[model samples]
Target chain A: MDDKDRELLRILEENSRLSVEEIGSMTNLIPAEIEARIHALEESKIIRKYTTVINWEKAGNAEVSAIIELKVSPERDFGYDRIAERLSRFKEVRTLRLITGTYDLQLMVSGKNMQDVSRFVSEHVAPMDRIRETATHIVMKSYKENGNTLFEQQEAERLPYSF
Target chain B: MRNFVSDRAREIPPSGIRKFFDLVMTMDDVISLGVGEPDFRTPWNICESGIYSIEQGVTSYTSNRGLQTLRDALSARLASQYQLKYSPDDEMIITTGVSEALDIAVRAIVNPGDEILIAEPSYVSYAPCVTLAGGTPVPVECTEEDHFRLNPDKLLEKITPKTRALIINFPNNPTGAVMKKEDLEPIADILSDKDLLLISDEVYSELTYESSHTAAATVKDLWERTITLNGFSKAYAMTGWRVGFLCAPKDICDAALKIHQYVMLCAPVMGQVGAVEALRSAEDEKTSMVNEYRLRRNMFVAGLNKIGLTCHVPEGAFYAFPSVRGTGLSDVDFAERLLKEQKVAVVPGSVFGRGGDYHLRCAYAVSRKDLSEALTRMETFISGL
Candidate 1:
C-alpha cells in the first residue's frame, strides 16, 4: 500500500495532471488501486498542489531572476525562523534555503526586471533588522540546477510504511 | 514556479574532496597539496593590459560574444598553435572563465535524461555539470594503465542510444594527461560516427611540455560537433582574472552566448584586455612556466617514486597524480591521514571519479622551494605511515 503511494507521488511529480486511470497504467496498477493510493498520498500531504510548470522563457514573461544571499539577524528574542516568516511574505521570494556557510540565508528571489529586484532588495531584504550583510550573486546563469531525484525504490526506503 | 531542484540533485554525493579540504584547513602544520588551483599570479603583461583597460574606461559591457580583439586574438592563437580555426565573430564567446564556458556548454546542449560520457579521474566539473544539466554522467573510468587518457574504445562502450555528448579535458586536471593529435583523432572520428557533440576543455592547452595541443576542431569532420573551452587562467597565470573563451559553430555559439550575455554581459571587461595582451606579448611566459613546471614535474615524480608512491609522468598541466596504494587506506582516508598527520594537502582521486580510489593529485605549480618542502613533508608522512 505504501509502495503504491510512492508510485502515485512520483507519477504526480512527473505530470501533475495525470488522471487516476492514466497514473495507474503508468505505474502498472489498476485504476481503483491508483485512486485509493492517490487519495491516501494527497491526504498525507505528499502530493501537494498540482502546479503548472511553465517554461518561463517560452511563456513570454522574460522575468529576470536573481539570487541574493542575506546575513540576517532576527530580533533579540525572535530566532531566524521568525525573520524567514516575515521575508517569505513578499510575493517575489521563490525559494529560500537557510544555508550553512558564510551567509545564513540564500534567497532565490526574482522580479520582472532589475528595477523591481533592486526595489525588493533595498526596501525589504536589505533593511531587515540585524541583516549583517547581503551579497547578491544575481545568478548570472545556472548551467544546471539540481535535478537529482531518488529512484522509486530508494524513495520507498526513505518513507515510513504502515503496512 | 519552475522547479529549483532536479532529479540529479539527489543522485550523487556532494564533493567529499572539497569537504575534506575544508576540514583540513583547521589543522596545523599540514603540508597540503590538496587545493586544485595553480600558484602563480596573472603575468605582469596581462595585468598591465587589465589596468590599462580600466584606465581607458573600456569598463562597459562589450558585445555579447565578447570583445572583437580578444576573440580574434584567441582564434589566431588557437590556429597558429594548435591547427584549429574558428571564426572570431561567428564561433566564439568570451565567458567569465572556463567555469562559465563549461556551464553554458552543458546547458546549451543537454536535455533531461540524456547521458554525458566523461573520461573519469579527469576533470571534476564534467560529471557534476552533467548531473545538474539533467543528464546522466556516465564516467568511463580511465586507469593508470591509460595514463588517464580517455580510451576511444572505452568511450564507445559507454555510449548508448541516449548518449548526448562526450566531454574531453586533456592536459587533464588531477592527472595532467594531455591527449596528442594522434591520440585524439580516433575519438574525433568516433564523435563524427556517433553524431555526438564534444565538449573539449583545453584550458591547460598552452602548458603542455610534450606534443602540441590537439584541438578537437583540428579533426576535419568534428569541428561542427565540438565546443572548445580555453582560458588564460592556467597557461598565462590569469586564474583570478576569470577570462575564458568558448568557440563553436555559429549556431551553438549563439545559444551559449545568450546565456553568457544574461549571466555576464562580458568577461570582466578588463580581463578581456588582459587576454588580448596575454596572447599578444607573452609567448615567453608560456614557455618559461612550462619549463619550470617540467622541472618541478620531474622533481615531484622522482620524489614520489623514491618514497614508493607510483606516478604517471603528467604529460601536461601542473598536477602530479600519484598512487597512495601502499598505505592500506582508501584514497579519502589516506588524504585525511596525510593532511592531519603530515600537513600535505593533495586532493584524493575519489573526488574525481571511481578508480581514483588509490590515488591523489599533488599540484606542483608552487615555488620550487615550497615543492621541495612539500615533498619532504610528504615523504616523512608516508614513511611514518
Candidate 2:
C-alpha cells in the first residue's frame, strides 16, 4: 500500500470511530475520498473489524486464564496442521500456536474461574487421543495485554519554550 | 501605563510570527507547520541528568558562565566538530537559550545609532534584539534566486561608516538556506576586508542535510571578530531547559558576561547539568534526528512541488520557505486564509524583512503523518485559491 493508505490504516488502528471528515483533514484527503478508501479497505478485508479494547476487570468480568502446552502425536501425512485446526475449534481457546522446543502446540484458554479452567483442561484436553502430555500455566495477574498497560499510562508534562 | 514602558520596548513591534501563533493557539484541530523547535523530547539521558541534579539538591544557580564541566564539554565539542577553538573559562558564557545570547551579543558591541546589518528573511528576533540594544538593524535583502545566500556585493553596498557588525544565521531559520565551505569563501573574503564584526548565529548548524556546515568564525581571519552562538535547544531537543552558549574573543565575552551577570544571574543549575550530559551523550541522538528531518524535508518539498507550489529544497534547518506567489496571495493573506479555511497554520514570510513578501515558512519538524496531511491541505487550499 501507498504512504497515504498506510497512514490511514495507522490512524484507524488508533481510533476507528473518527469520522471521514476528521480523517480527511488529518490525511489531506476530502471526506468523499476518505469514505471511498475506507470502503475499499473494508471490502478487501484489509480492515478486518472495528473493535473496542475493554478493560475486562473494570467491566466486572474477571477471567481465569492459562497457557496450556500440549505434546501431540500427528497423523501420518497430515502433520501438525490437522491437530492444530481441531484445537482452534474449542470455545475455551482464546489463542493457539504451534511452538518449538518440547511442545508441539500451545493454547491460551480462559474461563470464569480456576475450577472452570481446570475442569476444561482435564475433561477436554487431557482425554484427547492425540494429546500425550499437557502443562498448564495459570496467569495470576496481567500487568500488560495487547500492547496496552493495565495501569494508567503516565503523561509527563512538557516544559514549553520558544527556540 | 503606556508611558511607563521604555521607548525601545514600545517602538519594537510584537513578533509577527507570535501574533499568528497566538491566533492559531485559540483554534482547535489546526495542523501547524509553524513551530521552530524540534518535535522530539529531550533525550532520556539528558533528562535523567536534570532529574538527578534535582534529586541531589543541585537546585542553586550555577556560575554565571554555567558549570565548568558543561563549558569544557561545549569547548571540546566545538573543537572536535567544527574545528573552532574557544577557551571555556574566559571566552564563553552560557545564557538562557540562544534568545538571550543573541540579545547580549547585540548589546555587547552595538552602541546607540550603530548599524547592524542582517540578511532578510531570517529569524524574527534578530532585528528586535538589535533595536532593543539601541542599534539600527539594516536589512540586506537575500533573494530566492541566490538561494537566500547573503550576497557579498549587496552586503558591500549596505555597509556604511556607522555599520558595526553583520549578523548572519547559516542553515537559517524561516528559509533553511545553507552555505557550503566554497560558498562561504567569497563571503569570508569580503568580510575580511571590512572593519565590521561578524555575529554568526549557528543554532541550526547540526541540522545540515547535504554537507557539513561551515561556521563563520572558522573562516581564515574571521575568528577574532565573529561571535559564534550555539545551543542544545535545537540540536538536542532541549529548548525548555533554557541553555545556550556564546563564544567570542575574550574581550567581547567579558563584556557580554557583565551584561549577562546583571540581566540574568546564571543559567539554571539543572539545565547546566543536563547540558553537560547532552554534550557527552547526544551526538548520536542529534544525528538520528537530523536523518529523520532529512526524510521529512525530502517528502514535504517533493510533495509541495508536486502540488504546484514551488519550494526550493532547503539544505538545512527544518523549515521550507516555499513561494506562494503563483497563487496570487500575499504571504499574510495566504497564511490567514489557510488557517481559517483549511485548519492549517503556517507563518507568513513578510515578517522576516524586505525580501519575504510572497513566501510562507513551513517548518517540517513535525510528524511524517502531519507533514503529509498538511501538504495535502495546502495543495487543496492552493487549488481552491
Candidate 3:
C-alpha cells in the first residue's frame, strides 16, 4: 500500500465510523479516489473488518475470558496446522496461536461465565486428538485490549484558553 | 501613599485571550477553537523520562545555561537541520519557555526609547513584552491580502534610526503564516544592510505542512544578528514542562544569560532530562502528531470555507484565519455572537493587532468530533445571520 493508503488505514483504525468525505478531507484526497483506494484495499483483504471496541461489562453483558495453553504432538506433514484449524472453528475460541516455549498452542477462549468457560475447556478442548496436557488461566481483569485501554482514558485538564 | 504598580506594568494591557477565557469558563459544553495548544499529552516515552528523572531525585536546578547534554543535543540539531552553528557552552541558554526567552531577548537588547518593529496580526505578548522592557513596539502590518506573510517593504517602512531589532514568528500564531526560504531571503537582504537584529520565535517550526521551516539565522549574514527562540511546548506537547532554548552570537547570548541567571536561575532539571529524550528518540511520535494536525487542518479549513467563512489555507501552525466580513460584523462582534449563539469559541483576530480586523482566529488543535460539531453549529449560526 502507498503512504496515503497507510495513512487512511491509520485514521480508520482509530475511528472506523468516520465518513468517506471526512476521510477525504483529512487525507487531502477526493471522495472518488478515497472510495476507489478503500475498495481496492478491502478487495485485497488488507482493510479487514471494521469493528467497534466495546466494554461488555459496562453494557451489562460481562463474560469470562481465559488463556488456555495446550501441549500437543505435531502430526507428520500437517504439523500443528491441522489441529489449529480445527480449534479455530470453535465459537468460544476468540484467538488461537501456535506458541513457542512450553506451550504448543495458546487460545483465548471466552464464554458467558467462568463455569461455562471451564466446561468448554474440560469437555471439548482437553479430549482433543494428540493433546497431551491443558492448562487454563482465567483472566481476572483486562487493563488493555487491542491497543485500547479498558480503564478510563486520561483527561487532559487544560484551561479553556491559552496562547 | 504612592501607587503600588509601576508605570511599565500598569501600561501593559491584559492579554486579549484572557477575557475570552473567562467567558468560556462560565459556559457549558463550549467547543473552543480559541486555544493555541495541542490537544495531545506529552508522548509516553518523553513523560516517562521526566518521571524517571524525578524518581531518581534529579529535581534540583540545572546549570544556569541548562544541562550540557541538552544544549549539546540542541546545538547538534540546529546544525543538522538548518546548518546554523552555536557553541553549547556560551552561545545557548535554556529558559523557562519561549515566553521567558522572548522576555529576556527583549530585555537584553532594548535600551530606553529603542523601537522594535514587530509584524502585525502577531502573538499578543510580543508588543507588551517590548513595552515592559522600556522599548517602543512599532507594528509593521502584514495583511490577509498577502496571506499574512511579513512583507519586506512594510518591514522597511517601520525602520528608523531608533529601531534596534525586529521580532518575527512563523509559522505565525493566530494566522498560521509560514515564511519559506525564498519568502525570507528578501527580508534577510533588507536586514543585512541595516543594523537591526532579528529575534526569530520558531516555536511552530515543526508544525509546517507544506515545506520544512527555514531558520532565520540560516539566511546569509543573518546568523550574526538573529536570536533564535524555540521550545518543546508545541511540537512535543510539553507546555507544562516549560523548556525553551535561546541561541545567538556569544555577545548577545551572554547578555541574555546575565538576565536569565539572576531572574530565573535555570530551567527545571527534570524537564531538561525529558527534552533530551525527546530530541534523542521522539521523532516518530512528533511526526505522527504533526500528521494528525495536517489532517485536521485540511478538514477544518475546508469545512470553514464550505460554511461560507472563507479561510486561507494555513501552510503551518494549527490556526485558521477566516474572514468574518461576509457577515457584515466586526471580528469582536462575530466572536462574541458565535460563542453566545452557537457555543463555539474562537478568538477575535483584532486582538492580535493591526490588519486583524474582520477576521477570526480558529485553532484546529482540537479533536475531529469537536471540530465537526463546531463547524455545524457555526454553519447554523452563519445561516441565521
Candidate 4:
C-alpha cells in the first residue's frame, strides 16, 4: 500500500516467524504500530496465512505431485469459471491457475502416492462435464518451491575472523 | 642464514589479533561477528554472466585498464552519481580488488619518507599499506567524542612539509563511521591549503544507512587531488570475483596503470564481464541486500544497547563498535572470554588501532537468528561478568 507497508511485507515474506518487537526494530516502528499494521494487512487480505515450507521427504511423509493441464469446452453461460470453481474444491489441488500457452487451466495437485494421484485424475478430473482432454505430468523432484530451495542451502564459507 | 625478508616487510608488525583468530578457528559453535565481508553470495545474474562469458570462451586478458564497457559504465555511474567526470579510456583502471587499488594508489603517490596521515581505528591495512609503499604513516586519532570522524584540527596537526597524502575511508570498516558533506567540508578546506593528495577508499560507500555516501572527490577543490577507489565487493557481494575501480586525474591514473600493467596485467576477464553486468543490471539486488543490512544494523545495535553495552548506531558499514569498558574488561579480554564462555566470536577493537581500546567490533552481516542468539549469549556473559 505504501513504501513502509511494502517493506514490512518484504520482511515478513522472507521470515514470517519474526516477533512483533523484532520486526518493529528492523522497520524503525514501535511494537504497537507493527501490531496494528499487521492486523490491517490481514484484514485487507494483503497478508495471507503464514505457512511453513516443509521437506516432506526429510520428514518421512513424502507425497506424490503432478501438474495437470486441462483443455475444456466452455459451458453455454458459465465458461471456464464453472469448471475452475469445481477444480478448486478438491483438497488435493494445492494450486489452480488460468494459464496461457496451450493450456486453459493448470492444477498443481498432490496425493499420498502416484497411484492415488492417477486414480484422482482418472476418476474425477477427466470425467467433468466441460473437461474435454486432460494431461497430467508427475513431478519427479522439487528443487525449489514457494520461493524456497528444497535442497540444503549452502552456507557462506568464511573464516571466523577477518579485518 | 641471512634474513631474506626486506626491512619494510619485517617492520610491518603482524596483526595483533592473529592469535585470537587462531583461537576462534579452534573452537566450535562460535557465532562469528568478526568478518568484514557480506554474507550474501554474488547475485545470480552476475554469476550467470560470468559463467556465460567463460562458456562462450570470452576468457582472455582484457586491456590493461579492464574492459571498455565496464569502464564506460563506471564512468557514467560516477558522473551521474557524484558529477565527477573521468575518462574511461585514460582515468580509470580496474584492479584485482580494492586491496590492489589501494596498494597501487599508495605506491604510485608515495615517495621515500613522505608522511601519509591515516585516521586511526581504521581498517587494519591502511597503515601497513602506507609503510609498504615507503611512506611513514602518521596516525590521526578519531575519538568516540567526535563520533570517530577525522576532526579538521587533528588532520591539520598531522600535516607537515613532508606530508604527501591523506587516506580516508567512510562507512568505515571497524567503527562504521561516515562523513556527510558538511563533515567533510572542513577536511577539504584543510587539504585545499596543503599540497597533499587524498586517497579515498569508498568501498563501503553504498552501505550507508542514514544518508547517501559523499565521495571525497565530490568535496570542494578535492577532485583534482583525490584518488577514488571502489569495487563490487561490499555492495554486490562479489568479493571473490575481485573487481575494483581506481579513478583519478589522468596523470595519477597513468602512473597507477603502469604499475598495474607490469605487476597484475589486468583483472580477470570473467570478473570484468560480471562487473559490466553488475553495473548494468544488479541495482535491484544490491538495493535489497543493502536494505537487509540496514534492518540488521538497527536490530543488532539496539540489541547491543539493550544488553547494557553502549553502542552508537552505525550510520554506515556493517560493524557495530560498542564500548565494553563498563564490563570491567579490556577489549581483548572481552573478546576472548566471550568466545570461551559463550561461543561468540567478535573482534577486539584495539586491533584496529588508537582510540579503539575497550571496544569490540561486532559485524552484523550475519543472519537475524544468529544475531539474536549471539545477543542472548552475550547478555549472559555480560551479566556474569
Candidate 5:
C-alpha cells in the first residue's frame, strides 16, 4: 500500500464510523480525496469488511467456539482449495486456513453451546466425503481478539500536563 | 490571615504550557496538539487487573515503598531490559507518578543554594521542581544542530561549584530527542569527575523509535549517583493509574522515601496491581503502540517540513518540535495565531525553556485524522503569515 492508503486503512480500522470530513482532516486530504481513496480501497477489496467486535458474552450470546484441526485428503486438481472453499461456505465456520504439518486445515467453528458445537462437528463436519480425521478444541476464554479486548471500555484519565 | 504556603512553593513558576490550554478551553472545535498525552487507552488486561484488584478487596494503602510484589516485578523487568539491578526492598520506591518521584528525588538530593543544570526545551516540571526543592535551576541550551541532544561542553559551561545535580529526560518531552549510549558517554565522563547527582526522567524511554534506549544508570559508574524515574503513564497508557517508580542507590532511595512517606504514603493499590500486569504482559502491547506512534511521527514530521516549517526527525516520544521561524513569528505568536485562525492548538516551544524560542511542540498522539487535519490547518496558517 502507498502511504496515504496505509493511513486511510489505519484510520478506518480505528473507527469506521468517522465521517468523510473527519477522515479527510486526519489524513490532510480533502473530502473528495478521502471519498475517492476509500472508494478505490473498497473496489480493490483492500477493505473487505467494516465490522465492530462485540463482547458477545456480555451481549448475552454465550456461543461456544472451537478451533478444529482437519486432516483432509485433497481432490486432484485444486489441492486443498476446493475443500477449503466448501468449508468456508458453512455459516458456522468463522475462519478457515490450509496448513502444513499434521493438520491440513484449521477451522474456527462456533455454535450455541458445547453440545451444539459437538453436534455440528460430528454430524456435518466429520461425516464429510473428503474427511480423514478431525480434532476440536473449544475456546474457553478470549484475552484479545482482532486487536480489541472483550471488556467494557475504561474512562481516560491523563494528567493535563505537557510533559 | 494565616500565611499557609511555603516560600519554596511560592517561588516556583506555573507552567507556561497551560496558557494555550486555558485559551483552548474557551474555544470550540479546536484540534489540540497541546497536551502530550497518549490517545490510546491503557491495554485491556492491565485495566482488567486493576478492576480485578478492586473486586478482590485489594483496596487500602500499600507499603510506603509500594507493594513488595510490584517492586519485585519492576526490579526484574528493569534488570532484564537494561542490565541495571536494584534491590526491590531498599533501592526502589514506587511513587504516585513520575511527577511525584521527580519531586521527591529533587528534594532528597538538593540542598539549599545548590544549582541543578537542566538541558533546555526540557520537560516543564524540571526547573519548577528544582526551585521548589530550594535549588537553582540552570538551563543549559541544546540547539537543533545537535538535534536537541545535550552537548557536554555547553553543560560544562553551565556548571559551577554549587552545581549539585543534573536532570536529563531522554526520548525528551517537547523536542522528542533521544541520545545513544555514545552520545551520553562524554557527558558521563564529565559527570564522573564531579560529585553531582544525575536525575534521569526516562518516562518516555520505551517510546523511542529505531534506536534502543540506554538508561543513564547503565553508564559505567553512573548507577551509583543516578536516580532513574519511570512510570506506566506513557508506556502502558496508564496515566490515570498514577504509578511510577524510582531506582537509586540505597542511601538516596532512603532519603527520598522519607519525603515520600510523609507527603504521599504510597501509590494507589489498584494502580500497583495494574502496574504488575503491565510489567508482565505489556512488552508486546507497548511494541505495537510504539509502532503506531512511529507512523504518526513520520506523517506529521514530513507534513511540517513540506509546509515550510523545518522539523528535526524526532527519533522518540510523540512530539514534533518544528521551527516556526520561517513564518516570521515568535513561537507564542505562531501558536496563538494558529489557534485563533485555524482552531488548532499546539504549545509554544519556549514554554519548555532555552533554545526553543523559534519552535512549537505538536503532539502526534491524537488520531491520525486529527493530526492530518492539524497539519493542514497549520500549513494554511503559516502560508498566510
Candidate 6:
C-alpha cells in the first residue's frame, strides 16, 4: 500500500472510531474527500468492522481466559464455514480463528474457573457432532495479547475511562 | 457461482477513532483524554427527579411529543436564556439527543441530492447524518483566521439551486466557536426570499463566555423557517441520560414526530423528568460549570501559547483548539505520537472538518486535577518535540 493508504490503515488499526473529519486531518484531506477515500479503503477490504475493545478484567468480572486448540471434523454437507459459524454462536468464544496446523481452529474463551471451562467443553463444544477433539492451555501469564495490547498482564492501578 | 458485495459499502472505511480507542484500552498507564463525554455527573437535582420518576412508576411512555411539563420548562428556559419563544406544546419534541434531532429534521425535510450547508470544523455527526438522510453535505469551511466563524460571503457563494437547508452548530464542537447575531443576520436575510430551511444546533448555548448567546431563531425572518436543537447533555452534564429537544414550526414537527414515533417511540421517560428538573432549577449549577470551563479555557490557551502553540481565545464551549505547528508534525501525527510517547490523548482537528488543519482539540471537561497533570506531561513532551 502507498504511504497515505498505509497511514490510513495504521490509524484505523489503532482506532476505528475516528471520524472522517479526524482521519482527513491526519492525511490532509477534506471530510467529504476523505469520506470517498475511506469508502475506497472499505471496498478494497482494507478497513473492516468497527468494534469496541472492552477491558473486561477491570469491569469487575473475575474471569480467566484461555486459548484452546480444536481439530474439528468438517461436515461433508456444510464444510468448515458451517462448523466455524456454529462454534461462533457462543458468548464465551472471544475469538475463533480457523488455522492450518495441528489444530483446525484457535479458540479464545473466558470462564470463571476450571469447572466453567470444563462445562463449556462438555455442554457446548464436545456435544456438537461437527466433532472436535480439543486441547486446553490456560494462560498463566500474558506478556502480550494480540501482538501489541496490554491485555495479558495483571495490574493494580485504576484505569482511566471505565468501560 | 459467486455473489459479490457492492463497491460502495466496501469503499467506506470504518471510523479511525474506534480503532485507536481499542488499542488504548489494551495498554497500561494510558492516561486517556480520548473520550469526548463530560466527566461530571448529571446534576443531583436532576438525578433526584429521575429517581422520583422511577419511584412514582412513570416508566411507561409519555406523549409522542414528550412530557408536556418538560417541554414547557424548555420553552420557558429558551425564552429566559436567549429570548426565543416557542409554544412548547406545538413546536417542541423531546428527542434522544441532538444527534437524533438532526436525523429526524433532515429526514423530514430534504430530498435526495438536496444540498445542506454546514460549517467546518464542526461536530462529526453533521455530514454523515446529512448523507444518510439522502442529502449532500456541502461543507463551507470556516477558518480560524476569521475567529472560526462562517464567512457569510463563502456561505452565500456555496448556495446552489439544490440547497435545501443550512445546518448551523454553535458554540461549535472542536473549535468551540459561537456565532453572534451579527454573523447570523446576513444569512437570515438571504434565506428570506429562498425556498430553504435552517437547522440551528444550540446544544452548547448555555456555556458561552464572552457574549450572551443569540439564538438564530431570535433573529426575525429566521424563526419562521428554523428548527432549533438544544439538549440536556452539555448544559446539564447528562450525556448518558439521552434527552434533548427540537423546536420548529408545527407542520415540520408533525412530519418529524411520525418518523420519531416509529423510530424512537419516546425518549427515556426518566430522562425527560431529569431534564425538566435541570431546566427549572440549579441555574447556578449551570453557571458554576460554565465558570469553571471559562477558567479552564483561559488557562489552557495561556499554557498552549506559552508552549509555542497558537490557539484562539475561544468564546464558548469547553474545548481548546490549539494549532500544533510548533511540533513540526501534522495534526494526526502529533496526536498519535503524543499518545504513544507521552501517554496523553487529544483528538486531531480535521476530524471536525477540513477547516481544522494543523490543530488539536483538547477537551477540558476532565477534572482540573487530571487537566493539570496532563498539561505538565504535555509541556515536557512538546518541549522535546
Give the true-contact fraction for every prediction, in order: 0.00, 0.08, 0.78, 0.86, 0.30, 0.08
Tens-digit per-residue lDDT, B317-344, candidate 3: 8999999999999999999999989999
- For every candidate, the chain B TM-score is 0.95, 0.97, 0.98, 0.98, 0.98, 0.95
- The DockQ score of candidate 6 comes to 0.04
Deviation in Å, model 6, residue B232 alpha carbon: 0.3
User: In candidate 5, which residue pairs clash?
Assistant: A25-B373, A26-B369
Residue ranges of candidate 2 with Cα displaced over 4 Å = A1-163, B17-19
What is the C-alpha RMSD, rounded to one decimal, of candidate 3? 1.9
Q: Top model by lDDT, which number?
A: 3
* DockQ class, candidate 4: medium
By lDDT, the better pick of 1 and 3 is 3
- For model 2, which pairs clash? none
Q: Highest DockQ among the candidates is held by which one? A: 4
Task: Provide the fnat value for model 1, as a fraction from 0 to 1.
Answer: 0.00
lDDT of 4 at B49: 98
Question: Candidate 5: lDDT of A88?
Answer: 92
Q: What is the C-alpha lDDT profile of model 6 across B140-244, one tens digit per residue?
A: 889988888888788888899999989888888878898998888887887776767999988888889889899999887888899999898888888888898
Quote each prediction's TM-score. Answer: 0.68, 0.75, 0.95, 0.96, 0.79, 0.69
Docking class of 2: incorrect
**What interface RMSD, in Å and to 1 decimal, does model 6 have?**
11.2
TM-score quality measure for candidate 6? 0.69
DockQ of each: 0.01, 0.09, 0.72, 0.80, 0.22, 0.04
lDDT of each: 0.78, 0.87, 0.92, 0.92, 0.88, 0.80
